[model samples]
Target: MQEFALIMAGILLAGAPLVLATLGETITEKAGVINLSLDGTMLLAAMASFALASATGSAWTGALGGMAVGAAVASVLGLTNIYLGQSQLAVGFILTLLTRDLAYFLGHSYSRQPGPSLGYWGIPGLSETPLLDLLLGRQSPVVSISLAAIALCWWWMYKTNAGMRLRAVGESPRAAFGRGIRVRFSRLMACLAGGALVGLAGAAYSLAVKPGWGRPQGCEGAGWIALAIVIFGGWHPVRAAIGAYFFAALQVSGIYLQDIFPSIPAQVFQVAPFPMMIVTLLAVNLGRVGFVQDLMRRYPFLKRFSGSWPITAPAALGQDFDPKKGL
Candidate 1:
């Protein structure tokens, strides 16, 4: 039982980064911006956080540094895409490569260095409760922050006028503009805020989960996974968080499988989650397929539940919002 609790804790901690990244992307997409550079943003932020932490020996400072890097990169992406009217996707992709290579080059000196970690913070009474402790009480502060971020983002996006405007801009810039909303400003704000969250996720990876700047790159590929989880969750904060935890659970289960089935190759277990998530993404996007439509028609009940099950992206996702074109 204790082992199970520990395993659950590990899974939650692992999911923290994904939760943050997915939610950030959801917000960015909701505002009609596609920051496809999440992969690079996370990588650069991770590297920057670790480097700063090792140099200053302060985890908080490192986190701020990481956020700065994320915000800066996001600002550039937003400015070029929103103001300059460049292709968001193309600019994001190019920035991704550029930031990634820049991290590898600039972060060379900080590689394999020791950094301060957010050590465990075990609450006395709360930590004693097995389930409660594992879920919320006994975790590190970073885990708690991730949970809080989810609830806060969900509320902000669903219950606020500002959030409605964000959705409005994404759904129809023309309509939103007619209502006196600043489409470009909203998108730029969203991009910056979303990037900060992504940076925080990267900081969480280095300053707590993995606990150092070294070999193995614990944060590698996380950005891509988070992006997939965003789609899998249908772009809703709560659903996206669930997807993050689900993916983390799968990853932990793979480790267990490696132990149970010693005869199987370890690499297989390691690579399984990627393909599984790919299948999930494909399934989400395939909802409108002819076969799916036919099945839905055959089962009237399916139509009623489809929307509730897989949250869909905003209609204008990835499109450039042009205010000059009568918007």
Candidate 2:
């Protein structure tokens, strides 16, 4: 039981960065923008945050710096696509390459260098408890913040007027503009905010989850995984967080499996989670197939069990919006 608790805690800690990045993209897409620069943004942010933290000797400062880097990258993507009329895919792809190379170039000095990192801070009362300690008591602040972000985003999206306007912009910018919402501004803000979260995720990676700056970074493909989770989660914060945790569990399982079967090459365990996640994504989308649709229709109750039943992208996603053209 103690081992199980410890494993669950590990999943939560490992999954925190993913949760933040996925939620960040969810917000960006919910506002009718696709920031394909996430992979690069995370890499750059990770390097920047670690460098800043090492220089300043303050983890919080590093975190904020990382967020700034993320927001800056996002701004470029949002502005070029939204205002300059550049294709979002093109801009995002280019930025990914740019930021990635930039990180590698600039981060050479910090490779494998020791730096201050976030330490465990257990909740006072809960830290002493038996199973609870293993599960939630002894975690870094980043994990707590990641969990909180899930609820905060969900509330903001469903219960706030600003969020409504943002959703309006995503669903139909022309209609939203008719309703007096500032479509471009809302999308831009969402991009910036989402990018910040992605940056924070990067900071968390270096300062807490993986700890330290180096080549390979150990988080290379995390941004892509976060992107897939957003689609699998149907753009809902809670569902998306669940997807992050599920992936994290797969990762934890791989580690344990290595111990159980020593004959299996370690590389197999390390790479297994990625392909497994891709397969799960494919399975989730199977609901879109005709036979599956027919099966769901035959037994409507099945819809309740299938979270992907109504999953879809925002109506205006990846499309440019120009206020000057006006509805």
Candidate 3:
């Protein structure tokens, strides 16, 4: 029974962070904005959170600082894509690559130093409960917060008029503009909000997940996986949360596998996540599936769901978003 409880705990730990970031990205995409720069946002947040926490011994402050960095970076993407008439996907992807290189260059020294990490918060009486304790006795302050955010985003996106406009913009910007809606403004707001959530996701990695910060400290492809999860979740907040947790579980399980199967090469375990991520990407983008069209028709409620968003066109892709065309 104890072993059973331990296994469940392991699954929950794996699912938490992925749930946060995926749901956050899911919200952003629901508004027709995609922030590929999540990678940078996460890395920056990780560094900033770690640095601030180390300097002041306030984990909350560090997390907030990381969120700020993520929001600021996300705002830049919104500005470029909305105001400057840049490709939202291209701008976001570029920002992701740029932020990573910059963090690596700036984080050389800090990466070398180890800092305090967020200790698991064991709920007092709840943890004492027989079976529940093993399942949720150990909760991060942010896990509850993440779940709350997902619920909030769902309400905002689906239960409100503003959300309606946001969805219209994503579905067809020109059609939305024709309806007298402020499509650009809506998109911009979505971008900023998305950026802030991505930031929160990054900060979680630094202050809550890891004990310290350094180069490659805050995040690696966590942001990219968040992107995939958004698709896996069908651009819905709740599904995104589940997708995130699934990814997290895979990650946490990898550690156990490493120890259990010591005969297996460590590098294989290390690279396990990438394959999982790749498979998830392919599986989530099920447009090519045989019953995809039938599935959509059968589940009429899924008509509103969005799928994988493209970040850029090939060197010679179809028509661009021409300003002359009034896009």
Clashing pairs in 3: 14-248, 14-249, 15-245, 18-244, 19-244, 111-214
Question: How many residue pairs clash in each candidate at the backbone level?
Answer: 0, 0, 6
lDDT of 2 by residue, 1-327 (tens): 999999999999999999999999999999999988999999999999999999999989999999999999999998898889999989998998999899999999999999988888778788567899888888888889999999999999999999899888999999999989888889999999999999999999999998899989977989889999999898889999999999999999999999999999999999999999999888888888899889999999988866534578899998898888869
- Ranking of candidates on TM-score, top first: 2, 1, 3
Best by lDDT: 2
Per-model TM against the reference: 0.95, 0.96, 0.83
Please give the lDDT score for candidate 3. 0.72
> Candidate 1 lDDT, tens digit per residue, 1-327?
778888889888989988989889999998989888888888888889989887788888999998888889999999999999899989998998998888888888877776687777776788567777776676777788888999999999989999999999999888889999999999999999999999888888888888766545687888889888888888889999999998888888999999999999999999898898888778666767888879998998878755666666798888887777784
Q: What is every candidate's alpha-carbon RMSD to the true fold?
A: 1.6, 1.5, 5.2
Candidates 1 and 2 compared by TM-score, better number: 2
Rank by lDDT, descending? 2, 1, 3
Using alpha carbons, what is the TM-score of model 3?
Answer: 0.83
Total clashes for model 1: 0
Single out the weakest 10-residue window by summed lDDT for candidate 1: 304-313
Tell me model 2's lDDT, rounded to 2 decimals.
0.92
